[model samples]
Target chain A: MGVVVPLEDDRGRGQNAVAQLQALVAKEMQAVNEFIRERMASDVPMVPELASHLINSGGKRLRPMLTIAASRLCGYNGTDHIKLAATVEFLHTATLLHDDVVDESDMRRGAKTARMLWGNQASVLVGDFLLGRAFKLMVETKSLRALEIIADAASVIAEGEVMQLAAAKDTGTTEDAYLRVIQAKTAALFAAATEIGAVISEKNGSEAAALESYGRNLGIAFQLVDDALDYGGRAASLGKNVGDDFREGKITLPVVLAFRRGNAEERAFWERTLQQGDRQEGDLEHAVDLMNKHAALEDTILRARHYGAIANDALAIFPDSPYRQALTDLVDFCINRNH
Target chain B: MGVVVPLEDDRGRGQNAVAQLQALVAKEMQAVNEFIRERMASDVPMVPELASHLINSGGKRLRPMLTIAASRLCGYNGTDHIKLAATVEFLHTATLLHDDVVDESDMRRGAKTARMLWGNQASVLVGDFLLGRAFKLMVETKSLRALEIIADAASVIAEGEVMQLAAAKDTGTTEDAYLRVIQAKTAALFAAATEIGAVISEKNGSEAAALESYGRNLGIAFQLVDDALDYGGRAASLGKNVGDDFREGKITLPVVLAFRRGNAEERAFWERTLQQGDRQEGDLEHAVDLMNKHAALEDTILRARHYGAIANDALAIFPDSPYRQALTDLVDFCINRNH
Candidate 1:
């Protein structure tokens, strides 16, 4: 089952809002766990080992939660939501495995990555196994629209990765290019997670469109917050070491904004520390200072909040329910969560 | 389109025996190529570039040819064979892209590997792209049986790679384990390629069994020849430099054979050069001499010939036709061809 954090009384009025969402998330998460375990069960040895390593690695399961929340919001009561939820989770896990290999990363979620422990060979092959398993799950849903949307999203995810690789460490990358990559790599799956629920349940055009928009905005907000955390948040808060983006020469939104608005000296700092791939011990601290001075980090936070607001607005079409409220809370949490 | 090689001419066979098989192989190859190009057309930018690079990179297209040949021999005339052929090629290319990353090799088929040219990131992602594309192609066939077969094969392939990694440089690996690894890594796709045709076309149970056996035997033979070529063949003949497997620490059939049969001193040589991971000048030559003296390469070649004969025997169920004869020629080619 999915994990849902319950709100404590000390949180005040927000406690009621959080409690309402927690109960729905808890019930849906139970179903999701059953679905994932049943689907992941295999006679093959490597399949179970590699897949379970990722599936049990304690991802927030945000994508699946989105699917469950969307399905509940549409007044649907069927087990297909579980399948759709697992499908989204599997897709996310597959990407993580591949991403770790691409980045040659040693750590993920403060633990050694699959590539680190099992080697890139196993990580890549298992990533592939998970992908095939995802498709097998989607095919079982038997909704042509679900298949088309998910498959198209997968293609976009791969294309986005290629685009990112091409654009890595390049100062010329535009905000538009960054937006396209984020939408493809992150939001495409999110859109599918919510949209597939409406699609499988045969929701009307307007309802499906609204759910998709909510998923897209929430995904954008989540990724922007993640980018910000890389530069500004603590390891305790982010569950990852800061400055990983700069080390990997990843030109994220905060850095892009800083480079755009910073003065000449600040531009030299940005070029040497981030773009030129030379960083001193205090480079991360200096970069953070520059980002604050240029208001780049603030600008990025505002953009994330904007998307979060847009996510909340998209749910206005759905009738008032605890599940719908939880969905809205999730958008807020994307910006507010430390890890 | 698939490459067409004259079979009987190399064997100095009678003209009557060669004409039918060559014509059938040519016709089937044309269909397979058309299917591949048609399926690979995509709106994704890097996808077309990456896909075409692998598809057009002068692979012998042997696996798809085997599929088409097997289907025709089983009296299948439907167009689904083309899709099956393309599916097999896509699966094969996906493995190659992944294998290059795993092996850390920079060249394939006498040209720079996709990983080398585009970097491991592109290679890994594009490999995923081809894999997803393969599934999409299979789903269009609307055959659940086809889907199940391909899915099972993909899982086995992943397991096989893991098994190899686990067993690499471990002298404890037996001939049986070696066979299992090759079966999972190589024969599963070959078996699927042939069996899917019979299942999709609704062939008789006995015919299906025969085709499956033919594919399995031919696949084993193909791999055996490849292993032998890695040890003994010249770069010009194999399209790759010699001693590649040894460099990767892969203990193939010949090495296993030599390790088992060699005396104490020869076994010590194996351990020092391969297992100990220290190779001085002429180490490869010395290993080759040891393998030759132990008759390991000859034994491997004999085993390959044995499987090739079995592949030929599996064709007894089919009526004598040009297609059947071409399938038979492929058995000979697998064992005898240098490349």
Candidate 2:
């Protein structure tokens, strides 16, 4: 019922929290992986060709693992969680494919995006195929609550992406709006992923709500760290160029904070670089300088830690067990990791 | 049914089959339309802008009308059909938005496509939003059978699109493969639309399967006639440019039939114009001439009539009623109408 390990004490465990969860759910994770492989296949050659390009790409399977882990934590032993895990993974993969097309992103998971390899049309269609498959998987579970949660998440996530598009490159975007975007776009799925685990396990309302809270906070922290990493983290682990978000003129937490705190001259710089998308050589470096000048990245990480603490506390209701402990550690990993 | 007044004698009614069904389901259709308007209205500005551009752009509401009519045909009087109808329309609209992007089409139903006005990214994202909304609607129905049918159709439709892409610009595409493409892409939704009507009514398996067969055959016939019309019908009625399929090198039934029956010189023309996509100034004219020479368009319509007969026969099990008669006449209208 208290903080298992303080957020400041994470340096003591150098072990990768995601890897730890993966090992704990290795059996269920393998089944989910196999299910994904089997379901993604189709008679249409381009479907698998375009879909597998993204599916086989190096995703961490973090969301699916969370689904499996939450169900196990609820003390339910059944095969429905496997289908739910695969369902969430399919939903995640589908959104990524559509996202690449929306952002015109050429790279993801250290590889050429499906939109790059195939055209935007293929990415959109194949992403739809994956989504359709996700719904099919959910229907097979015959748990109406699970279906409702996932379906609502799908709508919220799409709405969030649209909101992000509206907010993109606008220096006037507020921290609150950015949080809304990340919550809807990123955390909704995470919330659904873990929430469905409890729902399928027939857990009580309070426990289900706790898991949902745990996932939502963890997802927010996860996205905050990712946004922060775009400017400050190591480029290799990210599998993307540093300042990619800056170049894309994405208005994330660091940029929003920096813009809010800047003087007139710095404000003009942001307006010219981000709002106008007129980037030149060293513009990224200059933007990074501004973020440092305002301590934006550091503050963003601190904000993420606040959410991470909430996520840790949400799991406190569950009894001490390997699954609960793994989930608890996952929150710390979400806040601390660069990629 | 005795061929339902023969496909050639549909002029006797002087009433549009779609109009008859629309009048029959006016109350439910009004609810479905209002639901579409309300659901399509999202807080996201671009979501509605892109969605309404297609939704309100003069669609006949034929699919949803079918849903309402089929439910009425089963003598059940509940409001779930309104939701299911909306679900089918949302699915149809979502696919159309994506199809326009995939086809790079600039105009549809005599209007500029959403992709043409707002960019492919908007179309893709908004289409995803609509699809998410469709799944939400289906989940709200709380009918697992309906969800399973629609979800499966979504996958089949997407797979059909991928297959159509593979078949595009290929003169070697056979008639059987072409049928598979249309059956999957077009007929699957039609089948799901009508079948769900029977399903939510608690119709027995045989009755449900009969409705499915009627819809599937009607949809196939509907698409076949449209494909043939692209070659033989007047361009003004089509709301699209004549020879669109020819220009796109879509290997539909007409093109497949022409390819199968052409002499060596004509075959060379198809290979150069279709397979190589190297069309000249008069190529469309020449293509029509070849189709006329082989009577390919006529044969395509004849094939459509053949399916229409099967569709009519499929409804013989139902008692004589206005809904049954309208559906039977719909088969003839599907084959005989140019647009």
Could you report the DockQ of all the candidates, in the order they appear?
0.43, 0.70
Best by lDDT: 2
> For each candidate, C-alpha RMSD in Å?
4.6, 4.3
Candidate 1 C-alpha RMSD relative to the actual structure: 4.6
The candidate scoring highest on DockQ is: 2
lDDT of 1: 0.77
Assess chain B of each prediction and give its TM-score: 0.90, 0.95
For model 2, state the Cα shift of residue B139 in Å: 1.6
| lDDT tens digits by residue: candidate 1, B85-168 | 898899889888998998899777778888877788988987777776787777777766676677778777877787787787
| Tens-digit lDDT string for candidate 2 (B1-339) | 011122346644524776787678898889998998888877788889889989999888889988888888998798989999999999999999999989888889878899899888778888888888898888888999999999999999988988888778788898889999999999999999999999999995877888999999999999998887787542212233567787777888988988889999999999999889899998888888888788887888889888888878988898999999889877866776655
Q: Is the docking of candidate 2 incorrect, acceptable, medium or high quality?
A: medium
List lDDT for all candidates, in order.
0.77, 0.85
lDDT (Cα, 0-100) at A111 in candidate 2: 84
Task: Point out the worst 10-residue segment of candidate 2 chain B by lDDT.
Answer: B1-10
Task: Score candidate 1 by DockQ.
Answer: 0.43
